[model samples]
Target chain A: MSLLEFLDYSGVAVFAATGALAASRKELDLIGFLFLAAVTGIGGGTLRDLILGQAPVFWVMRPTYVVVCVAMGVLVFFTAHLFESRYRLLVWLDAIGLSAYCVMGAAKGLAATASPTVAIVTGTMTAAFGGILRDILANEPSVLLRPEIYVTAALSGAALFTLSSEMGAPLWLASLAGAILAFGVRGGALAFGWTFPPYKARPGRHPDDVM
Target chain B: MSLLEFLDYSGVAVFAATGALAASRKELDLIGFLFLAAVTGIGGGTLRDLILGQAPVFWVMRPTYVVVCVAMGVLVFFTAHLFESRYRLLVWLDAIGLSAYCVMGAAKGLAATASPTVAIVTGTMTAAFGGILRDILANEPSVLLRPEIYVTAALSGAALFTLSSEMGAPLWLASLAGAILAFGVRGGALAFGWTFPPYKARPGRHPDDVM
Candidate 1:
């Protein structure tokens, strides 16, 4: 398989594992694990394809991706308890998936739209939206609302990839650099609890008064 | 406009109003209200189109649907506080949208897929998924998890429409009957607190043991 294809499959598997772990925490049944895993594995790409007008979507074109997700869900279901810190493992696995998806999504976006701004936005959405769906379905607090820098890493990675490609970098080099930068930023957040400042509402500003 | 077309637009507007009210409850800014309104208005149709392989999606093709949603957001932003019970209004508006979407979604699905089962599923999703997305984005407990018969109402409406059409009923008659059934079921739930029995897990059945 090509490097990009390999990354795509691995990213789907890793994200599915994280989803299964989430299901385990919720004490859901096997069906729940499979459902969550499948959704988290492919939700981002599905949304991206819909927005970009890619008919049949990625998984509908290649059902192997769903098989891979189901396999990860089954694997995680039996073995989740063996891990001492499943949450930590889920976070790290998600980081890996995020990095890969950002570059791949950006590459696909650039190819389809030929617009760097759209590519960056699609890339970020591809990386982060699956996790958002996972959290929402599992009734967990959204990763988007967390203090740590999650989406920022995906956005930056996508931006970097778009910039590098625009600057005439080789495809492989751009992909590698983008993935590494994303993983590094997310790693820093996990290791050091790095975060952006939370938004503080102005006390006197009312909703009705704003518009 | 045709009756179906009119219902579709009304559904979008009503759904958007509910979404704007959700944003109001969260005390979000104008942008947040618009974003939530747009998403809640079109999310279900977007998903249905993607699954049915309809390229460009409904809103992208019309664009007027999005304009309707934005108008609702702006109107609700300024006028939301005037309602004595915003939640009750939101629920009633949502019920109206749900009933319309179920029939519309079923019709579209049957036209696209030529399968009654697919039509029913798509109809239910079109009716309910937008509200699910709204609640998730607004951090409200999902209507799906509520004891009330929400999805069941959508599902029955879709099924009824598909069945009536298959039985040689006129399009308008089938549509009206299906919509009224959905609304009646939902209204019964709201007025009488009707609910399906909750799922009960069997004791000693473990996830690992299931498969």
Candidate 2:
């Protein structure tokens, strides 16, 4: 398989594993785990394809992505308890998937729409939206609402990759750089508890008056 | 405008209003209201079109739907306090949108795929998914997990429309019947507090052993 394709599949598997771990925390049945895994694995890509008008979305076209997700769900179901901290594992696995998916999504967006702005937006969305869906479904606090630098990391990777490709960098080099940068940012956040400042209401104005 | 087009726009407007009400409860700004309104209004049809392989999506092609949603957001932002019970209004408006959209979605599904089964499923999804997206984004409890007969109402309308149309009924008659049935079921639930039974675990099998 091509490097890009390999990264795409790996991202799917890792994201699916994180989703299954969430189901384990919820104490859901096997079907719930499989459902969450599939949705979390493919949700972002599906939204990207819909927005970009890519018919018969990637999972519908290949089916192997879903197979990988289900396999991960089943595997995680039996072995989740073996991990000392499932939440920690979930975070790290999600970081890997986010790093891989951001670059892959950017590449697909560039190829499909040939618009750098769209590429960057789609790339960030592709990396983050699956987790958003997973959290919503599992009734967990969304990563988007957390003060962490999760989406910022994805956005940085996408922007960097898009800029590098536009500057005539080799595809492989751009992809590797983007992935590493994303992972590094996320790792920093996890290890050091890095966070963005929360939004603050103006001192004198009413909350409803901001609009 | 044709009847179907009228219903479709009404559905968008009503659903958008519901979304704006959700934002109001959260004390969000104007931008948040607009974002939630737009997503809740168009999310379901977008999903249906994507699954049916309709390119460019409905809102992307027409743009009027989004305009309507923005208008609703602005209106609701200024006037939400007028209502004594915003939640009650939101539920009623949602029911109206659900009834109209279920029939319209089924018609589109039937026209696009010419398969009754796909029509039924797509119709139910189209009616229900927008609300699901709205709840998730607003951090509210999803209607899907509730015992209330929300999805079943949508499903009944979709199934009724598909069945009637397939039986050589006139388009207008089938659409009206289907919509009324959906509204009736939802109204009954609202007025009488009707709900479906929750799933029961087996006497001895553990939750994890269900698989």
Candidate 3:
């Protein structure tokens, strides 16, 4: 529980930073920057809770997550230049955030008394959804249908986490292993240009063929 | 059933047109335009279906909706100028579309095994979510959470439709009444500056206020 809490706060801080970085590119106001940060920081968990039919949502219930985001927002508002150089650092931090949230989401699902498969899928969704939403809000493409291996890495980590838990592993070990695996897979994908292939269908009279 | 089909198709076309207007403003490519149109036309339905746990979603089950979005995309591609003035036209067309879809969604929910309350909420949600998605995609503020009475109008229409149906009213009469009610309410709000008051929570200090 201690580790989970630490990771949740840390993940939120990193996501908030990246979100601030992303928003800076849009040249929006301070409110927009903070809104982006808040959305990216807790967006995944909120979506997961909503889909699970949970009430109040995590951020709404605890409300600390919003504070964390706002704090980061204030920091970014003043120190935005700290993030201007070397976008590579942002990517690594994002991967770490994703890994943390992946394990957290799985743990949340398990706590919710869902089945293993449901837990695994839910965890992956929790990890991936924040970035997807961030991309959408940033006016970039939604990452859901993108070719990237983002979802796959989260899925891999979540599967391993669920499997370990089913095999009687300790909760702490399960979470640690899942986070490491997710971080590694996403890191590898970033380094190696790994991606899912394009979706295919019958290639006939559709005008969409020209695209 | 025929009325349902008509409203459903009309909603698709009008929403697609609205999406095209958004995309044209951004000078999006064909892919982006088509994607935006699809999201605008079917986004509300997709959200409603997912929340209701409806499987295989309407577009996934029937490719025709995708085709319709693509076809509209092509039309917009060739004649973007014809829609140069569409935003003005769309204000009313969208109100009509909202009216049509609220009743459609309510009817679908009422027919399904869901509770009446859920049905009522789902119907309003179904009518409102498309524009919500469109604004999100267009990187504009969400109309749903705005001071505008967008969601309230949809709720009124949905209630009217559901109640009329339960009273054994004919489908046309119920749909017409619901449509007019929704349209009028939304129109009135637009004309008269109606708005939802902000949440009543006391204002807070900066950074601390977010929580």
- Say which prediction, candidate 1 or candidate 3, comes out ahead on DockQ: 1
Residue B207, candidate 2: C-alpha displacement in angstroms: 12
User: What is residue B37's positional error in candidate 2, in angstroms?
Assistant: 2.2
Give lDDT tens digits, candidate 1, residues B103-134: 99999999888899999999999899999989
True-structure Cα RMSD, model 2:
7.3
Task: For candidate 3, give the lDDT of residue A16.
Answer: 83
In candidate 1, what are the lDDT values of residues A1-211, reduced to their tens digit? 8777877898788989989989999999999999999999998888888777985799999999999999999999999999999999999999999998998889888887677866776787689888888998999987755667787788789989999999999988888899999999999999999875432223544433310
* Every model: Cα RMSD to truth: 7.6, 7.3, 10.7
Residue A23, candidate 3: C-alpha displacement in angstroms: 1.5
- The Cα RMSD in angstroms, rounded to one decimal, for candidate 3 relative to the true structure is 10.7
Per-prediction TM-score of chain B?
0.94, 0.94, 0.86
On residues B30-90, what C-alpha lDDT tens digit does candidate 3 reach at each position?
A: 5556656766887777677766766435654455665687687667766655433545555
Q: What is the C-alpha lDDT of each candidate?
A: 0.85, 0.85, 0.74
Q: Least accurate stretch of 10 residues (summed lDDT) in model 1 chain A?
A: A202-211
TM-score of 3: 0.57
Query: Residue pairs in steric clash, candidate 1?
Result: none
Write down the TM-score of model 1's second chain: 0.94
